[model samples]
Target chain A: MARRGDELMEFSGSISTLEELHALSLMVHEVASDWGISEKVLFEVSLIVEEFCSNSVKYGGIPVGVGIKLADSVITIMITDSGKPFDPTEVAVPDVTLPLEERKAGGLGIHFVNHFADTIVYSRENGRNILKIEKKI
Target chain B: MLINTSQKENLQIVSIEGRLDSLTAPELELWIRDNLASPEFDVVMDFSNLDYISSAGLRVMLNLSKAAARYSRKFSVCQAQDHIREVFEISGFDSFIPLCDSLDDVLAL
Candidate 1:
């Protein structure tokens, strides 16, 4: 388990399986609820975690660790994966204006992660991909 | 997730309860695909009891929408909770898919 401070609630797991994804979702929901976060903000945080964790598992093929810190009117999430050097923030945004026929779902997950998070930063260090995201409640 | 299906005229209504996340999204997609391949051409998914949705769930909906378009079938989603509807709006799914306020709205289409 990774911990930043006494106030931080952290969860870590292998991202190679769907079962872990399910567990991760449950854990995040529990922590968010325990912290008395609103349902709307919790849902957004859950969505961001799901998209990033699924992407890392399906595409990055590595283990992931997530740390969450809750503060008044602000929540910060840090996701670390030991996989390929990929930065989610650098992904291109999909064209939402395209007609249904021309639209492909390739980049929508990353797009949503970008849209919901108030601020996101990505970096690679020691062969690990670290993504930090912040949201305003 | 709990899925209940009922029929109103030619349309099949699927009411999904609980969260629709990465783990269960494939099941929903498969169910919709099976129905589309069968005699069922028109479908409406009711999300009144749905608590949450992630990108994976949204992808399943998009696939169903595209499949419906390809087969000349009718498909729409109704009764989405405010949070779920916000997800749809941010993803821009509301533009391509028919989102109804109620089951009756979809039935009327």
Candidate 2:
């Protein structure tokens, strides 16, 4: 984790185990609180971080890196994964308009990412999947 | 997370406090499996003090709601934050599971 003079706080690392997610969660909460983020935004950021990284840690078995930057009331989230090239934006979104009995479980996390984020961009560079999510505070 | 169970009138109220993420969601799920016997008592999940919930948490609640339907038990959620309610709405949980604004609202159902 690197803290600069600017409001941007950058953290990038690899975790071999799932326990690291909790540590990451604590770090996220502490940073958000230090920056005086709203409860709702912080919660959204937490969810976004968890869902993105969990897929890598639990499914892809690859190391994940996260970056959080705050500038002008806009929070930017960057996630880099060394796992098998996967694109969250391409995931088939479950029909949220469906009734309860017809609803399915898959893609809800990506659905959440889309709803909470103002914009999302996915790319692949040098065998890494980079996902950038931006949210307005 | 703090789960306090109590009886209110005839409904069994289960208040969940703190973050309900993957790390803590299973405890609540196991508690429900071990404690609540469906079809006998109506269930109310109070989220007044819950600060966070991820998809894992939502999955558990959906299981409870589905079980309620399977056994013909009344299950409702109360006191969710606006953002949380939005989550339920986005996931289509509000259609089958009632997201009440308050305990009184739940009682009225």
Provide the clashing-pair count of each candidate structure.
Answer: 0, 0
Reference-based TM-score, model 2: 0.89
Instruction: Give me the runs in candidate 1 sitting further than 4 Å from their true place.
Output: A1-16
The candidate that achieves the highest lDDT relative to the unseen native structure: 2
Tens digits of per-residue lDDT, candidate 1, B8-88, equal 888888899988988888888877666655435587889999988887898888888888787787889999989998878
- Put down candidate 1 lDDT per residue, A66-127, tens digits, no spaces: 77777656688888888888988778888888888887777888888888889999988888
For model 2, residues B21-105, the per-residue Cα lDDT tens digits are 7678888999989887464678999999988888878888878887777777789999998888889988988888899988898
Q: Score chain A of model 1 by TM-score against the reference chain A.
A: 0.86
Model 2 share of native interface contacts: 0.42
Deviating ranges (above 4 Å) for candidate 2: A1-16, B37-39
For candidate 1, give the lDDT of residue B101. 97
lDDT of 2 by residue, A54-78 (tens): 7877766367888887777778888
Residue pairs with backbone atoms closer than 3 Å in model 2 (clashes) = none
> What's the lDDT for all of these models?
0.81, 0.82
